[model samples]
Target: MLERDSPTPLYEQVEALIKKNILNKTWPKGKKIPTEAELMKKFGVSRGTLKRAISNLQKNGYLVQRQGLGTFVQADIEIPLERGLYSFAEYFQAHHIDYSNKILSAKIPKKTSKVIADKLGITINDKYLCLRRLREVEGENIMLIENNINISSAPHIETADFSKESLFSIIERYSKETVEYSETKYSAVGANSEVSSYFSIKKGAPILYQEQLVHLSNNSIIEFARVWIKSNHFTLKTILHRK
Candidate 1:
């Protein structure tokens, strides 16, 4: 149900209509929405317009894409920042939120860059494993994480199956090191073409960027990471305690 003759753009009309349906419980939470073809025919809109509308609805936290599965209504997900050591998987598990991970790459580069070497306290010539993964919540791509880990600490890290395993857990089990704390820096950024493709969002959309250096109990830097989070669907919350 959309207004074609209204001055509002077709995509905006479609977005409003879909959002209304979601808010009114016409499309209940966790239920798959109509197919793109069906929506296009119903709205009498072009494919690009329909996709744009769906993307808008997704960015606003109303819908989720399940890769091969159809898009469905989204539920709330909250990640607490008060804890020093945070794990995305643990949070999802605790909240009982259905989630999945897609590993893009996990390999040891021939040459380590100065920036990565400096952060990990390794020589530029030393080898390190770089892992890139996308985290999906309720079938929606919500965050992209790029982790640079020292190979010397975890020799067989390159061969580890990250799809079903957590990187921090791997380090602890393989390297015999526990994550003590992390020095994190946060910033706001606009999604570039690469990031937009990963999140299926429009280029220049707002994103929350975080750079962190993870350390072991002995105070050795073991991992350096860059995380990009979808701004609309995720929020970073922290509680302050004064000693």
Candidate 2:
């Protein structure tokens, strides 16, 4: 039952309900959804309301409407990142999937580059922690992750061994600050020579590049990351909110 008197719009409530069905396998891949008239009658909403809901699901990669056969659930990816942040180690452990992190470098750099300085809101010569690692599954590396952390926000953070501990965990535990949220942008980028060497792939391989800035409870930015993920191993799904 949707909350009719709530501030949330009726169509958005309908969209959430339909998306839940798709996620829980209630509506399997390539399975056609109910007709618009049937959905309208069932939800007690107008055609306009229902169409907006379906249109959003289609745009977000959960549904596809063929020209002739109506709408069906899309063929999805192995992993989906909706709106939350996932520490790869914890996720793999929860699912009982064998995975390991090989730490490439984790230390406080003497001087940060201009790009890193701007991201962390620090001066170019100021100290900041940098971490680079490879995420391996089944003997193949699929992700290269690099993190630039605000040293002022997480003082003495370099003392912790990232290979044996979670970065966010250490930050929250030691600094007594909460990681509130993150802003992320996703794009397709071709791998250059440095990245190609890490993945053992040729230069110009298609890869998913994600840039993210994490904020603390006080709304100060604390971490910035550049993640290169093999397209074959992951999929990213984000919701659309017009307001």
Candidate 3:
């Protein structure tokens, strides 16, 4: 029952209740939630209030609405972006999310491009290991990652089992250098044929692209990565604090 005299808005109260039910597994993933009519009657709220509550939940990634159907619990994964210098593998392991990686290719290219060379703070002729990998959770391919690491900083990285290892961990272990911070840029892009094939989505599907340059505590760049993520299957979250 809603408190009619409370200062809190009725829509907010209803949203909180629905979100609680989701987190508690009372409403499981992919299952359709109660219809609008049912929910309005149960909460003794007007149609507009009930819709506002549901809309908020959908915007926050807690619910998904299908045309001609009803709203269902969203089953996508949420990745945090404010973890400082942590890797995706580390984050998933810490959160106990079941994940796996497939190493598509790993090699030291004979030629280096000017853009990648500059990002690694190396000359255009410097050799580096390029690793391409696909990350999956619950049998869905959610991310495609391409990492370029300076060979001098991470020796033998070309032979490492990236499918079972975190690139950041390996770099720290081999170079004895800690990652101080990273500069990242995020943008939305349309998937090409290759990316579309990897995610099994239609061509020109929306993708979230992230490019990052990782630096050591000494201020030396060690790694550059380009990541393509399935937009609908993942959400990037960040927490900001005021100084």
Candidate 4:
């Protein structure tokens, strides 16, 4: 029930109540909420007010609107994003979410983009392995990753099986070096045609983009990586400062 005389806006009150239902599981994930008319009737508010509240919830990750379908509760994944310059392989392990990786491509490229060359401190013609993978969890596509490894320094890496071995470990064993530090640039973007198909999302849907550089203990670059993260379900709790 809304307080007709209260100072807080009616729509804000409605948003809070809806969010509480989501958190408390009163409205379980994927369950569609009532229609605008029904919500207006239930809350004794105008259609405009109900719409405002619903829009607010959607923006804040509490709800998702599907075309031709009523709004539905969304499953939220709040994790430590941009951590240690690695990837979401840890997110699944930490949350106990069952996940699998599909190697899209793992091969040496004949040509390199200047951006990638600059990041790895190598020439455009340098020998490097490009690894592309699609990761899924609980039958939902989650991440697309591309790792550009400077295989020229670790020639034996060309024959290694990434499915059975960790890339970092392989690098260390072959090159006698380990990751000293890393830097990552993060941003939000719209899903491109290639990305939309992989995630089964509409074109231009929100996507999280990241570019990272892993450096060896000697300050030489190990790998330059790029990641495209499926937004909506994932929210970043970004508080970062390394001591």
In model 3, pairs of residues that clash are none
Error of 2 at 42 (Å): 51
Compared with the true structure, all predictions reach lDDT values of: 0.85, 0.80, 0.86, 0.80
lDDT of 2 by residue, 1-243 (tens): 788999999999999999899889898876898999989988899999999999888655567677777888865335546637766666676666556789899988777899988887888888888999998654456789998888788778888877766677887876679988888888999998888887776799888898999888877788899999866536666676788
Per residue, candidate 4 scores C-alpha lDDT tens digits across 1-243 of 788799999999999888888889898987998888888888899988989998878655668777777788876677665465434665666676667888899988889879888888999988788999888755567789898988766677867776544567777777788767778778999989999899877899999998888888888898888889987687777786889
What is the lDDT ranking, best to worst? 3, 1, 2, 4
Candidate 4 Cα misplacement greater than 4 A, ranges: 1-75, 81-86, 164-166, 240-243
- Supply the TM-score for candidate 3: 0.70
- Where's the lowest-lDDT run of ten residues in candidate 3? 76-85
User: What's the lDDT for candidate 3?
Assistant: 0.86
Q: In candidate 3, which residue ranges exceed 4 Å CA deviation?
A: 1-74
The model with the greatest TM-score is: 1
Better of 3 and 4 by lDDT: 3
lDDT of 2: 0.80
Candidate 1 residue-wise lDDT, 1-243, digit = tens: 667677989899899989998999999877899999998898888999999999888777889888798888875465677865767777777677777889998888888999999999999999999999998876568889999998798778788888877678988887798888999888999999989998888899899999999888878888999999987756677789899
